[model samples]
Target: MNRLNMGRACARAGLSLVAMASLSAWAQSGAERLALAAAAPRLSEVVVTAVRAPQPLTDVLADVTLIDRDQIAQSGAVTIADLLARQPGVELSRSGGPGTATSLFLRGAETRFTAVYIDGVRVDSQSTGGAPWEAIALGQVERIEIVRGPAAAVYGSDAVAGVVQIFTRQGDGPFTPYVGIGAGNRRTGKLEAGFSGKQGALDYSLGLQRDMSRGHDSHPGSNPDRDGYRQTAASGRIGLRLNEAHRVDLTGTYTDMDAQYDGFLPGLDDHGLNRLATLGASWTAQWSPAYSTRLSVSESQQRYEMVPTPPYLSRTRLRNYLLQNQWKEGAHTFTGTLERREDHLVNAPIDQGRHQDGLALGYGYVAGAHTVQLNLRHDRDSEFGGQTTGGVAYGFAFAPGWRATAAAGTAFRVPTLYQRFSEYGQPALLPEKGRNVEIGLHWGQAASRLGVTLYRNRVSNLINFGAPGACLSPFGCFENAGKARLQGLTFMAAHQVAGVNLSASLDLQQPKNLATGTLLARRAQRLLKLAADTRVAQWRLGAEWHLASHRWENAANTSRLGGYGLVNLYASTTVARQWDVLVRVDNVGDRSYQLAQGYPALPRSFFVGLRWTGR
Candidate 1:
C-alpha cells in the first residue's frame, strides 16, 4: 500500500476509535471508562508523565510526541541520543561514543535549558547541570515521551526548553522467560534475557543485558580516536495488583559503561566511564469515587569518570532521592513533590575546591483546563540565593478540531560547579534567569495534525566576559553583566496515510544580546527538520532531513560556521512476530562540517540489527 491509501485506512480506523471513546464517555461515566480499559482486551489509552499525571495525549493542554518501543526497535541506533537526535526541534552534541559526555538542545536554547528524566527521576548531572545523553544506551526502552516549550511550572528547573522522559520495561506475562544473542560489524555483540512470574500472591520480573561494540570510524581529528564501547545493565521489578482499590510497584536498575572519543583538547586521548543505579516505587489508593492519592519515591546514584588529563582520574557523583504525591478529584489534580539531589564532586585542579549540594522543592497542579507549577531551590553557594521558577498554561477546546493554548513562565539556573569552580574551565559567572510567554494553536488529531506556536524569552544576570585582560584568565570574569533575548516560531505537521507517516517541523529563532544589539554567539537562527516513516506490508522504511542556518562563535563575530544539511535512511522488516531485521544509514552524502567549534560530525556509516520482541 502507498501513502495515500494507507492514510485513508488509518483515518477510518482512527475515526472509529475516536467516536467510540467520545460516545463511551457520554453514554457511560468516567468511572465506567476507567473500568472498561481494564476489561477490554486491547489497550487504546496510554497516560504519560508528560503531565505529572495520567492524561490522554489528545486531551492534553500541551504539545506532546510519543515514540514507542516498536519505533525504537526499527531505528537501529545504539544510544538513546541517537534515537532522539531525530526529534523535531532537538539537536545533540557528544564528546565521543556512547557512555561519554553529551548535550541535547531543544528549540534554540542550550542544553542547560532542557530537562531529561527516566521513570520520573531527574538524571542530569548536578555538577554540570546537563544530562549526558551519550551515557545512555537505547537497548531496553519501552517508550519515549517529548513535550515541547517552557514547562518549568509543572516540572521544576531546567525545563526552559521542554522535557524528555523515557519509560523502561516493567515486566511480562504471569510467568514467562526468554533470551536472545546477536552480532554485527565493528565486532559488536549483544547478550540479553529476562523472566518474571507470580509466586502465589507475589509477582516479580528480572532482566539482564550486555553489549559491546568495537565501534566504527571516528570523526576526522588531529589526534585520531578508535571508537570502542561497552555497556552492562540489569533491572528487576515486582508489583501486586494487590486489590482493586490499592496497588504498589517497585523497580531497580544498575548500569555500567565505558567509551573512548576525540577529546578535542590537543593531544588528549579522551575516555570516560559511568556507573549508575536506581530504585523507585509507586503506591496508589482510592479513598472514594472522585478521590485518589498516589505516592512515588525514587533514589538514584550516578557517577562519571573522565581522563581529560590522563592518569589523573576524577569523579562526579550525584545521589538523588525524591518523594512526590498526587491527589485527584474530578478534573482537578494537585501535586506536591520534594526532591533532594546531593551532588559531590572532586575536580582535583590546582585552584579547584570540592563542591557539593542541598535540595529543591517543586509543586504543581492541573485543574480543569488550567495548569500551574513552581519550583524553589537553594544551593550550597548562596550568591545564587533561593531561586524560584514556574509557569502557567490555560487551554480550551474552542470547537471541533480546534484547540488553543496560552502560557507564560519564568526559570533560572545557578551556575554549574564546572562553570564556576573548574580551574581550567570556569568562565567566571553567576546564575542565569529567563522569562517567556507563548501562544499556540492545534488542528486535526487523526487524519492530520498541525500546530503553530510563537514565543519570546528574555534573559538577565548572564555570565559573560568582562573587559579582556581584567580577569586572571583570558576567558574573562563571569558576572550578570548583560542581557540576552530570544524569539522563535515552531511549526509542525503530521499526516499518516496508507501505513506511512509524513512528519515535518520548522523552527526559526533569533537570539541576540539586549545590551550590544548583536546576535548571540553560535545560536542557529533557523532550523528545519522533517521525517517520513513508512510500512509497506512487512517492510518499514524511514528518512529524515535537517537544515540549519549559519552561526557565529563569539561577540567579535570573526569566526562562523556555514549552514548545512543532513539526510539519513533506515529500513526494516519483520520475519515473524518474534523476530525482525534492521538496516540504517547515516550521513548519506558524507558531507564534512562542524557541528560545533573545532568539532566535526560523523561521516557516512551504516548499522544493522536483529531484534526479538515480546512473546
Candidate 2:
C-alpha cells in the first residue's frame, strides 16, 4: 500500500481515538480534571544540551524531550533504541534481536543526520558516519535529552535532523548499593551490580552488568538455528569540588559485546565482537556571580571485529577539546565557545584522519512574555575549507499556560572516511547541507501538558550511489544527488486522569526526493505512540502501544513494507523493604511484523527480574 492513502487512514484513526478520549474526559466533572491536574507531577524542568548550557526546557523554543532516570526504570525497556522508538518524531529499524545493528531516524531525516553524544562528546564514527545505536546500553544512562531540529549553529556538523545527548549516572546523597538479576524466554539471563555515593566535597558512581540471550532465528524460513548475543559493560563517574567557585569532574563508559548472526548460511560460526568506550574530564570555574567558564576534553572510541569467516576489523576514534564562557546581565545572556576535534579511523584496508576547528557565539534574552535566542558558528575542516551556520528562535506567551515558538536553522554533515577514501567512494563529494524551520504551540499546567509542532526541512548535495552515466571514478561510483525535502507534524499530550497517567503522541511526515518526487526509504509517513501507567499501593502497572504506517524499503518504491503495531505490558512492585520485582510481556499478541525487510522481530517474549537497593 502507498503511504498517501495509509497516512489518511491513520489520521482518521488517530482522530477517532482523540475524540473518544475527549468524550471520556468530558464525562468527568470539571472539578475532577482540576483535581487530577493538581495531583500530577510536573515534567522534568532542567535541560543542558538544547543550548549547550543549563536552561529550563520551557525556556528553549525547540521541539525537545527529556527522559529521566525514573522514567527509564519504569518503562521496562532494555535498549536505548527501544526507549527512543516511543518518542515523538523518532523511528527505529533493527536488523534482528538484541545486540544487533539498529538505525534511528528523526523527523524523516537519514540515519546519519542525527548526531549522538555521550555527555558533550560527539561519538558518531568517522568510518561509517553513524553512531552505534546497538552498542549504547541503557543501564548506564542517568538521563537522555533529545532536541528535534537543526542545532549545528551551537554544535558542529551532523546536526541536520537533531541531537541526542546521554548523561551518565552520578552519585547522590549517602553511599548506596544496588544489584539485580533477571531470566526470560529464549534462554536469556542478566546480572547487574552498582554502587553510588556522595561525600562532603566528592561524589562517585560505578556500575557493571552482563546480558546473554539465545535469540530466535533471524532468518525464519531458511535458517532455524538460534542466534546468540552476549554483552558486558561498565560505567563510572566522579566529581570533586575545590571550593564554592570551582569544580572538576570525570566520567567514563565502556561496553563489550559479542553477537551471533546468520552469514551466508545458517551456522553458529558467524559472530562479531563490538566495543564502545568514552572518557572525559571537565573543569568549571565561577569567576563571579554573573560570569562563568568551562574547559573540557574527551575521547570516544568504537571497534568492531568479525570472526569465523574472512576476519575483518575496523576502529574509529575521536578526540575533542572545548572552552566556553557565559555571562549574564539581568534578562540578557551571552556565550562564546571554541572547539577542536580530531578523527582517526583504521579499517585494515584503509586508514584516514581529519581535524576540525570551530567557534560559536550565542545570545539570549528573556523578560515578561517574550524570549529570544540566536547563535552563529564557523568551522574549518581539514578537507572542506570552511562552512558557516546560524539559527534564530523567538517565543511568545500570549496567556497563562500557553506559549508559541518559531525557529529556523542551518546544518551540515561531513562525509565519512569510507565515503571519501575507500573503494566505491568519491573523494570530491561535498558535505550535505540543509535548512530547517519549525513553529510550535505549547499549553501546560501542573496536571497536563499539550504540544504541537510543524516543520519543513530542505537538503542539498545529498550523497548517494551514482546513476549509470554519473560515475567518473575508475574504482567507485558515487555522486551528489540534487535535493530532498522533509515536512512533518508532531502532536503530543500528557495528562493525569484520576489516579492513572496517560500520554500520547502522533507524527505525520512526508520525505521526498525533489528530483524524482519519490518518498525516502525506510521512513513511515505516520506513527502513533500511547502509554499509560499508575501506582496503587506498592504495585505499579503500565502499558504501551506503537503503530507505524507503511514505508518503502528501496528508493524505487516498488518494495513496500507493511505497517505494524505492537503492544507491551509491564508490572512492578516492592516485595520487601529495599527490594523490588519487575515483570514484562513484549509483543503480547505475537503479531507478525517487520521494521526492516528480511529481518524478523521477536515475538511473545516474557521477562522477570528482581532488584535490591541498600544504603
Give the TM-score comparing model 1 with the true structure, all chains together.
Answer: 0.80
Using lDDT, give the best candidate's number. 2
What are the RMSDs of all candidates, in order?
Answer: 8.0, 3.9
lDDT of every model, 2 decimals: 0.63, 0.82
Runs off by more than 4 Å, candidate 2:
1-44, 467-476
CA lDDT, candidate 1, residue 240: 78
lDDT, candidate 2, 1-615, per-residue tens: 345875675567556654534211101111122223333433225678878988755466667677888778876687899888788888988877877778899999987899899877778876667888888888878899888889999988899999999998889999999999999999989899999999999999999999999988876664667878999999999999999999999999999989877666555467878899999999999999999999999999999887877677889999999999999999998999999989998986679899989999999988877889999999999999799999998887777666778899999988988777766577888999999998877665665666667789999998776654434456546668768888887767666787888877877888888877889888998898887888988899988888998999888788999999999999999899999899999999998888778778888888999999995
Candidate 1 lDDT for residue 292: 58
- Candidate 1: stretches off by over 4 Å: 1-47, 96-99, 176-191, 195-205, 216-221, 263-269, 311-314, 319-323, 349-385, 424-430, 464-478, 515-522, 553-556
Residue 443 of model 1 has an lDDT of: 54
Supply candidate 1's per-residue lDDT for 274. 79
